[model samples]
Structure formats: structure tokens, C-alpha cells
Target: MSNRWCAVVRCFVVGPIGNKFAPLGDPGRQSYEDSLQVFEEVIQAACQQVGIDPVRADQIAVAGEITEQVFRHLFEDDVVIADVSGGNPNVMYELGLRHATGKLTIQIGEFGQLPFDVNTVRTIQFSRSPRGLIDARNQLERALQAGLLDGQDVLTATRIFQESGEGKAEIDLPLPEPSIEVDGSDDEPGFLDNMIEIENQLALMTDNADGVASSIEVIGAVTESVGAELERAAQSGASNSARLALISKYASEISEPVEMLEKSSADFASNMTSINDGVLSVLGVIQNGDPSELPEGWDGFLDQLIGMAESSREGMEGLNTFGTAAEGLGSLSRQLRGPGRKINNSVGNMRKAIAKIDAWERAARSIKHKAANNPVG
Candidate 1:
């Protein structure tokens, strides 16, 4: 029986720290601290998952020569995790060495720092958020369970290529699309992880269905209340000035709720409009055709974007209806609108808004086309 056992692990925690001597910089020091914290959390989770001590390969480097110790760990460790957060040259070189070795190697980095070469390979995206860190750790744990416990000896191409006189052959066999395997309950979150969170949020919108109903009821109640007050004012034979006072008094009653709706509508519009920024990012990544596993599954991430886009469309629709309602409520008329509000006032921002929406549509279509043309394994 193969019993789970603790294992010696190595980390590229100090990337590009130096050539002969590890040079120290405040920026590098801060990066090391942050990246190391992330690495520590991930390794700890792996340890707990597979029953390993999660020993750092560089633990002894402090007592002796760092270069000799690091090079040894790079070649010998069963599993190695590299942090390429800043695209440090030393880390990149060491990562290349591990890549050549074809060992059970894992790579991680902060999202924005990865260069094209490194970014193309599968990597776990790191974030500093408490929840983000936890999610990253959970992802690492799942990956550890998948890669380590599977008990398979997959041959790495680099090992084979090095054996032949041909330095690096252009093989005819179609390269299998690289995928990240992970462990979790079947009900596990989608590739993005937050994908499940989005679904949960959409479900919460069902509760807001009740809110929408209550809003309607509130609208009716306010209407009836205002009508009654106006009726009383008319029956009392109040003058125009007095009647204006009466209506204004009732207007104050709905002011808060009206403001709340306005704020919500603005929020919805802003979020709806801003989603394009993320979509454009996806488009950029897809265009680059990086082989790495995305933080979100392409399909799932695209679907979530589609879902949010649809939700935002619906939200905009609702806001339009809300604006109409506000207009009808003569005394209680104040509402929020998107760039369309200023359509007549000026054409410039509205033109920009239309252009942005058009850009989003074009970008989305481009992504769909690219995904269709180049399906990943």
C-alpha cells in the first residue's frame, strides 16, 4: 500500500536575487516578502493535503553557499514551486531548468507581472486579498491532490528531445492542449472559482425579485398616499401656493427611496458599462493564444461574462422602466440614467459611450471567433 508521506519541496522564493552574490533591494525585498507569503500559504495547503512536511529546499542555503544549494534543490526535489511574480531573470532561468527537467513542477505569479513566455505556461494567479489568498491556497491544494496523488509517470518532451542529436525537433504530433487537473467535490466551483460566486449572486437576484415586487407595492403605496394628501388639500380649498406646499411635503416622503433607486440604477449602469474592460482583457489573452490554463476556464469565464452582460442588459432595461415610472410620478420625479441622459445636452460623451458599447460587442465577437477557430484540449 502506498502510504502518504512527507516530502522535501523546493521554492524559487528569491528570484533573481543575484548572480554571484544575492543583491538586496527594497523593492525586491518587498516582493520577496509578499510572494513568499503566498508561496508559504500554498505549500502549507499542499502539505496538509498530501501529508508532507512542506520543507523549503532553500532552508539550508542560509547556513552555506546559496547558489550551490539552490542549484542542487532545483535538480533534486520531488516537487518544485516557482514564483515568477516580477519576471526576475534568475527565476526565469531556474524555471527554464525545471522545465527542462520535466519534474512535477508548479509555477505561480502575481497576475500582471508575467512575461509572454512564462504567461503561456499554466500558472496559478496570486492575489493579496484575504479571500483571494484563501482561494489561491485552495486551488493549490486541489492541484497538489490532482498532480501528486494520481500516480502516473508522464514523460516530458524536453527529456526526449535532449537525448537526440536534433537539438529541438519540430515534431509532427499535434501537441496536446495543456490542462490543469484539480481535485474537489464534483460540485466544486468552476475554473474561475469566483464563477460559483457569480452564480450565487445571480441566485440572490431571485430574492431581489421579491424586492422588485415590494418596490412596486411601495410605489403604489406612495402614489396612494400622495393622492390622498392632494385630495385633502383640494377638499380644504387650499390656494395654489398651499397646494404646492402640500405636494412638496409628500415629495419629501418618497425622496429617500427615490434616491436609493437612483443610486442603484447608477451602480448597475456603471457595472454594466465597465464589464467591457474585463472582456477586452480576455480578448487580449485569447488573441495571444497562450497555452496556459486561465484563471477561469475559457468557456466558464466567457459564460460568466455573457451572464453578467445579460444581467446588465436586463438591469439597464429595468432602469429604463424606472425612469419612465419616475417621470409619471409628477411630484416624485427623480431618477438615474446612463450616458443617454445627456444625449441631447451634448453628443460627445454619448458618442463615446456608443463607441465603447460597440467595442465591447466587437471584442466579444472576436473572442467567440478565436475560441471557435482554436479550440483547446
Candidate 2:
């Protein structure tokens, strides 16, 4: 009831309207249209309660490009109430644009009909029943009051990524060179080629490992913030829909880092395979050749090779913990299609690579044993 909360001069409403936007003859056209009508009624009442005028794109009656006008409202409005029911593509796109502004955004949707991307963002949910409309209106009014009164903007995806340092700092790790240089002796053409390739591939894998490690930190920070928000929402004694909205919003917020983790893990897994193959090839050459006929610095090369293998194996093990975290988060929503599947696959790949490295490590030690025993030969 404070004038401070009612100080908003502009309000924009966006959502799917009746069959106007729905395809003709669609079986659910009537239902979609009806939901929009109810949503409009409730939104209007809520805005009126908060002493603000609400404008929807269809009501502008402008002669110019409606698309441009819509974008302008989405960006410039003091308050935006977006009904994301039906998961319409255009509605979702507009919602995303609004979220980028980090302004006051009120998301509402029909229960059980929200998209995976935003299903957890704090939302006012409603049905088409008379009682549902009243409840939705009351919820929206309180939301508008709290949002405008506190003067705090919604924590959006853009803000989350910015805070997570997604673009500010490069996640690349320094490429490591072999500690000892090998002379280009004519006796070891193929062996040198294989060893050099392994070194290059190992460098790339090291970068991936660094990326994965950094992403884990980001994920942890984001999750901690989300947990706090969840607790606050729960304490508010809000509806399930409201709590889910909070969860969904943070879930979306964490998505960027989760995606980074997936990609890094995947790249690391791929490079591990290539490096393993090269190591095996080099080992075969060493095993078949006379230890006395080996190239200069062959002993040093073996040491570096085993060292790289051990390092790679350890890095992969560390990354598996991140994979586990991703899987756990995905299970909560069961709809995080990308992060869940890809991270799990990367974990599987890393496990395989770990086994391969173990085998390669053993083989390398065997060759060293042979060289030690045949030192005088």
C-alpha cells in the first residue's frame, strides 16, 4: 500500500493470446486461448492493485513494426509481467530478452506446462477456474508490491554469468613443454614423431583439465547462492509454483558454467584417447627395438612419458567429481538434457582413459625394467 512500491510509470505484459497466435485448427487452441484470457484478467487486476497501468503488445494500436515495438517495451518497461504458459517459442524469446536487462520481471505460467528452461524460475501459476484466477491475482499483487517496494531487481541469467566470470577471464591453462629436449638423432625418426605428438596432445588435454577445474568452482558458487535463495523462498511459505520458479531461475543461471564443464570434460576425454594411442605406439617401438640402439635421451623421454600419463590420469579422476555434481543437479530436474547426458558421457570416457593410462604406465615400467637389466648389452 506504500506509494513507493506504486511508483512505477510503465508496465508491460507479454504472453500468448487466445488462438490469435496459435495455429488454426489446433486441438489445444481453445485451451490456450482461454488460459490467455484468464491470465490477462488476473494481470490487469494485479497491476491495478499496485496502482500501475499495464500494456500488452497487442493493445498498443501502433502502425509500425510490432516486433520492434515489443522489443522496446521489453527493454524499457519499469515492470514486466510475462506469462510463459504453453512454452511458446516467441514468449520464451521475449522472456529471455527481458531477463537480460536484470530488471523487474514477473513470470507467470500454467502449472505443469512451463518449459524446462524456465520451469523453476519463481512464477505465479494459475488455472482457468474462477478460484484459480483469484489466487493468481492475489499472488501477482503481492509480488508486485514486494518487487517494487524492495527496489531489488530479479537475479537474471546475464547477471549470473557476469558474476561467474564467464567472459571476463580466459580459462585456458598454460601449455606444458617436455622438461628435457630430445636430440634429432637419425636412429629414431618414428619414435620422435610419436613422442612429439603425445606432448602436443597432452598440452591440449591439460588445458581441458584446467577448464573443468575452473568450471567446478563456478558451479559451486552458483549452487551455494541458489541454495540460499531456495531457503528464503521456502521460509516465505509460498506456493509450490513460487518455490519452483526460484529453483528454475537459479537452474538457468547455473547453466552456462555447467555447459562449460561439459565441453571441457568432453575435450579432455577426446584428447586422452589420442594421447593414449600415441603412447602405446611409442611403447611398441621401444619394446621391439634394442635398448642399446635407442635414440639419445630415450631414458629421459620415458620418464616424461610416464609422468605425462600419470598426470593425465590424475586430472581425469579429479574431473569425475564434477561429472558427479552435474549428474546430481540434472537428476533434480530430470530435464537438463544437455549437461546431464554430455557430462555423464565425458565421465565414462575419462574412466576408460584412466584404465588405458594405467595399462600404458605398466608397459612403460616394464620397458624400463628391461633397459635396467640389459644396461651392459
Best by lDDT: 2
**Candidate 1 lDDT:** 0.51
Give the distance in Å from residue 23's predicted Cα in candidate 2 to where it truly belongs: 55
lDDT of each: 0.51, 0.69
Clash counts per candidate, in order, are 0, 9
- Taking the tens digit of each residue's C-alpha lDDT, what string does model 2 give over 214-273? 776786787789889888878988787876777687667767877787778778767777
Worst 10 residues of 2 by lDDT: 167-176
lDDT of 1 at 327: 44
- What pairs collide in candidate 2? 18-33, 120-244, 120-245, 120-248, 121-245, 121-248, 121-249, 122-245, 122-246
Which lDDT value does model 1 have at 49? 62
User: Model 1, 323-358: lDDT tens per residue?
Assistant: 445544444323222212321112222222333443
TM-score, structure 2 vs. true: 0.44
Estimate candidate 2's alpha-carbon lDDT, on a 0 to 1 scale: 0.69
Quickly count the clashes in candidate 2.
9
